[model samples]
Target chain A: MSTPFIITKASGESETFSLEKLRHSLLKSGASPETTEDIIEELERDFYSGMRSRTLYKKAFSLLRRRYKAQAARYQLKKAIMELGPSGYPFENFVGEIFKAQGYTVEVGVILQGHCVRHEVDVVAENETERILVECKYRNTPGFKCDVKIPLYVHSRFQDIEKEWRKLPGNHHKKIQGWVATNARFSGDAIQYGECVGLQLLGWDYPQSRSLRKWIDEDRLYPLTALTTLSKSEKQRLLEKDYILASELVSSPHCLEILNLTARRKHQIQNEVRQLCGNGD
Target chain B: MSTPFIITKASGESETFSLEKLRHSLLKSGASPETTEDIIEELERDFYSGMRSRTLYKKAFSLLRRRYKAQAARYQLKKAIMELGPSGYPFENFVGEIFKAQGYTVEVGVILQGHCVRHEVDVVAENETERILVECKYRNTPGFKCDVKIPLYVHSRFQDIEKEWRKLPGNHHKKIQGWVATNARFSGDAIQYGECVGLQLLGWDYPQSRSLRKWIDEDRLYPLTALTTLSKSEKQRLLEKDYILASELVSSPHCLEILNLTARRKHQIQNEVRQLCGNGD
Candidate 1:
């Protein structure tokens, strides 16, 4: 008679286990033929006598996901963006904010019209004497070549904007200036065209020097450098009003400079606080 | 006694074999003691009999050669370059060559001067009265941000160049009659700058539209067209003259285009060669 199955024990012992043997080992000592068949089928699929088969199953599972799902993929992307921080925001808007923060009176996302085309300019910054237009671009890939179409298009669009500016009331619009900021690189021909027409091709690096990186490095307006100088008590009141944020600002380089500039005054203030508190600590 | 090495050669059988057992098994075969030691060493290292060790040796040899030798590495790099073809070359140079091959008069490396920067244009192409400049950038990774320094520096450099060009002699000497190109991408500020200066920022798609891809695929030459234009007898004399590198002229796009343009009526000469048994096949 043939044995239906066999078992190799850990102690290096081997035994033939027939259906009769299985029934004998079971607690109830009785099983229906159908139940026996089902159990055997499951055992064949799930239980292997060797370790290698178990490893293979685990390896296969690791190589594949549970199933394809779009929602899960999007969640991962959103999580990644949120973690990358402020510089990761929409490229043009980020630069525009940087320019505004840099003490330039600015208008961002302005529309410009040209002779044959119309487009939007990203920023227009002005002072009492001069005006400048700024455009920002965010490019992800390499190999964008700027050539004829770009200059012709921008010139046409700028023309329309220039016409509208000419109609602006009084000298308020007289100093309006134009600029383009691109994250992508430009070709030589495009640069020459811009030169011929008096336009600027501020590729990726120029604006970083002028704006965004400047702000992150802590160039901000504060009390000492305020447009209007303040009295001692008024400055104290202002500091108290924003104490938590003011303290948090200490980590910035610009704030450190500000603190250094006011060292003598800060010492006096600290003495007063100490006198009131006594040796309480 | 010490534990003995064991191998179960038969089912339901358990046995232990020591060096003494091994000696007895081999003694009747008349192998020497040194031969037995060699056999034992091999068995120890490769206990799992079915596995082949040659693959490990081969991999080790390859690693040694690749790390220690320059020629092997260069050979691998060359093969990879050939495999990647046009895409493998710097995008700026590759795209410029494509335009040159297309019968356009092309200057591969050009320097453009702008009011605020100097830009190295990748290719300057002129056809009749039309002229354009191009820049190409190759990116291996996605989500690339343009560094602001280079473009701004270039802009500043361009300004100096332009200042010189504005002078009388330089004005005529340094006129770029066209656009700029970038393979990677431009930022919003760059686009605005382009507008301000009348430079065109042509995207990658624009150049690809001019059949640069198709020309590369078909290996078509302008010289073939020129050659077809030459009269039969004149074409024969020209081919016999050996004034040009026939192989390079046949293969190079620039040379081929020139030949096609110059050989406007030379197709009949090919028929004569065919009739004169020139076909070795």
Candidate 2:
């Protein structure tokens, strides 16, 4: 494009569309450099000033999908994570799996007694040296950022729980940590307060190299909802049965039997899951 | 009234109906003892097993309304306070008015910088020797309790603000306090945490003698929405214009001019406000 094209963002603010940013995202989705360049060139032909960023995203996503299903699914990972909730339970479970992947024994949705009161902690992960309490702030809306109130509340809750934990026998040496994880980004104040209070914050694109998105991509721990082969209802049923991660179905194919799918369709779903998770031979 | 009737409360818990409780409430609404007994007797005739307590309340309210409009309004104060919100702004303003009635100079919905971050406090009140920051938790739904998280978060926010307040040149001698006010009741844990951390909690029926209800009644600071003479839309318009209390209209009768209400209707509203607020000389 000769002149800068102003595109409306999800937040209703307009910014100049950058070819370099789009190219980087496409490449990050596992597309080849040539493929990313080709997609960007095609997209540039249709670019118009004042077009919505959502429309541009849909166009790019469809173009990517036509070339590779797994890459497209990976590209839409953030959106898929959002689809996990009208309720926050699924996201909490997803965070639990991430901790489990990192070799911690994780518990999802446990009510533990704090020093002052009982707190319903979203995820608790424990290893030999340390125990972590996670509070998940899930917002399904695009561009919704977790603000300072979240980290402030999470810090107090952790302090209460940590105090009680420190008093228990055989817990004298174990380090206690608080974490605030979200599928969305965190406001500047949220990060400042969280870090100042020694709380770990993991947002979709935060912490630079070790965000929630990075953690998911690191282990191919894609939520079941990210499988394009599965119907929405099919994925929801799997989620209801607590089959949250795609890797779970790959490891235990018997879980798919609950869906009562035809042999061919079941095989197709298994193939897609394995391919997407990089588990297929 | 021969066998005890089971009534479902708003929380969906069933309890045996108490005649003494009903009688006490009726008498408390400014009804004469004889009038209270008459209403109870009439209500007992229609009572059945497995009836909702809401039905009992409605029946008593309508029966009381037939005798006195002002008393009936007082009887429905809790529900009226709830009706002040689909948004919490009106409730916050009502809270400000309550603090004002207690002889404090108050600011509603003010954003003050905390030691760590800025906070949008619901109501800030100051007197010669004290400053109080209040967080109003308004729940439109009946039977919703303010859980421990509410107070835990409020206390942290208060601490952050208090830290900054302590550094202010003239605040050294002023007693800075944090308060959580709710239209709903607080969970036991919430009250415990709040009190443990020196935060004052005011709920609909909490602290026994000095609850939100008692405060409203102490000065006859009935919300404008509690005036039976005003329609919902009329009250809403007044609320939108920041005229939140019936006493607001009593002091500035000309505020009614914005509603374009008829002169007779205006006089009727003023008369009811005066009678309800005990300001009818």
Candidate 3:
């Protein structure tokens, strides 16, 4: 932060630790621009050369923690998202809810007959005008990207399902679409291929303004994994029971009894869920 | 044997059962040329119209079974190959042994570091001149084919591993190669893509002269699943214990005790293993 100096990265590699990079990371954590600038400038004056990136990251995290709880939580957003997976079913349900919020009737885990065989489609959201089949690609880490092959696979599959659909008596009336949604980003080729094939894609920050994050944020439909009150196993239990979103937890608080949580802990989780979803009731 | 007419297939679909097709199949089963022709000719006169494929299959199976038991076993090659899977590890180990028989040192389930991350390659065989990385795509049923996408995925993975190898201080000397071996056929595009990219592909009968079946046949290294003496659970146990090849079973016949077979059954299994591996002594 101070005078730009060299530091050791987590990859056991060396890089110049830039103030701009720190400021950008801070801004991403939801720090106010003015405060981010002030913190960076202050850290720079006090900092020494040859620092480890981990130490620098910790220092920034602590500063954000002291400044704002919400910003601190936002800093851990990637980790929170990652906690939702290993299986993408919960993410599929969450995406389905987002579509449901927008007035679409959603079905999760629909098995449709393809040309060659039957395929388990993640989400099917339909309204009077159209039906959309969505494939949810969930990765446990941010580093993994959905590549061209996924789009190719999905496009081929969509064609098969579409072929089978035509044989049904009244399937021709509604417009049908195929979509691939991922919490992670798509590789460059995936985006290009999907665009070329007219396959809709919605990744975390992809297509900029109307991405998966935007839909969830707008609807205030945060997944249970986003709650700090839930442990990894607790979150997993909730996800296993198909309680995907925080709003869903509020809707069926009775399900918490199966978790065998302490009375105090259950109350705390309920309070957090209500606060996160809204205080409308 | 009777003359064949239209027959219902395994898919419950109907097709004309041809004499030439039957002869080809018999020859593929390793039947003598004279007997194969005679069997087909004899069957043609006795067969009826509109027979189920299973009945025709059984008639041929009985004829071959009576003539040469070993050939009958070979005739069940597709089924035996299928029995090796659901998980391709046993098949992969068998492939490793095939390469081993050809005088290469083999490693199975080798986790190699790739450029982005690490990948667990099914088999890695090395000789003085070259090192080969093999990916075994095993399917439980013959209906599955290694499609164009598989080559694309394997090639991408190979490239990543190759990139990492280049970064290693002194890995340039050994010629590195990547291959994909499946117990089934490759889709047209898979072969096209593999040939175009110079990624070696060895499917059951792909690439003409050099196929997985050819290798196994040439080496006399049939998998344990080829033995009829073992039940499904017994074969599974053998596979789980990593006794992949019939030759391995012969070398360690004592391992057969855990299957809880009658003395006659154990003796029969041992005899088959010995015959299959050509260990007459």
What is candidate 2's TM-score for chain B alone?
0.76
Scored against the native two-chain complex, candidate 1 gets a DockQ of 0.01
What's the true lDDT of residue A231 in model 1? 41
lDDT of 2 by residue, B167-258 (tens): 98988999999999999999999998887778899999999989989889878999998889899998899989999998788799989988
* Chain A TM-score vs. truth, each candidate: 0.40, 0.77, 0.72
Candidate 1 per-residue lDDT, tens place, A246-268, comes to 12233332433333447665544
Runs of candidate 1 with Cα error greater than 4 angstroms are A1-84, A88-164, A167-173, A178-281, B1-89, B102-106, B112-116, B125-132, B137-176, B180-211, B214-281
Q: How high is the CA lDDT of each candidate model?
A: 0.42, 0.88, 0.78
Model 1 lDDT tens row, B62-120? 33332223223222322222222233234444455556656778775677654444556
For DockQ, candidate 2 versus 3, the one ahead is 2
Interface RMSD of 2: 1.3
Going through the candidates in the order shown, the clash numbers are 95, 0, 8
TM-score of each: 0.32, 0.73, 0.46
- Rank candidates by lDDT, best first: 2, 3, 1
- Model 1's alpha-carbon lDDT is 0.42
Native contacts retained, all candidates in order: 0.00, 0.46, 0.05
Which parts of model 2 have CA positions greater than 4 angstroms off? A1-67, A141-143, A259-267, A279-281, B1-67, B259-267, B279-281
Which docking class does model 1 fall in? incorrect
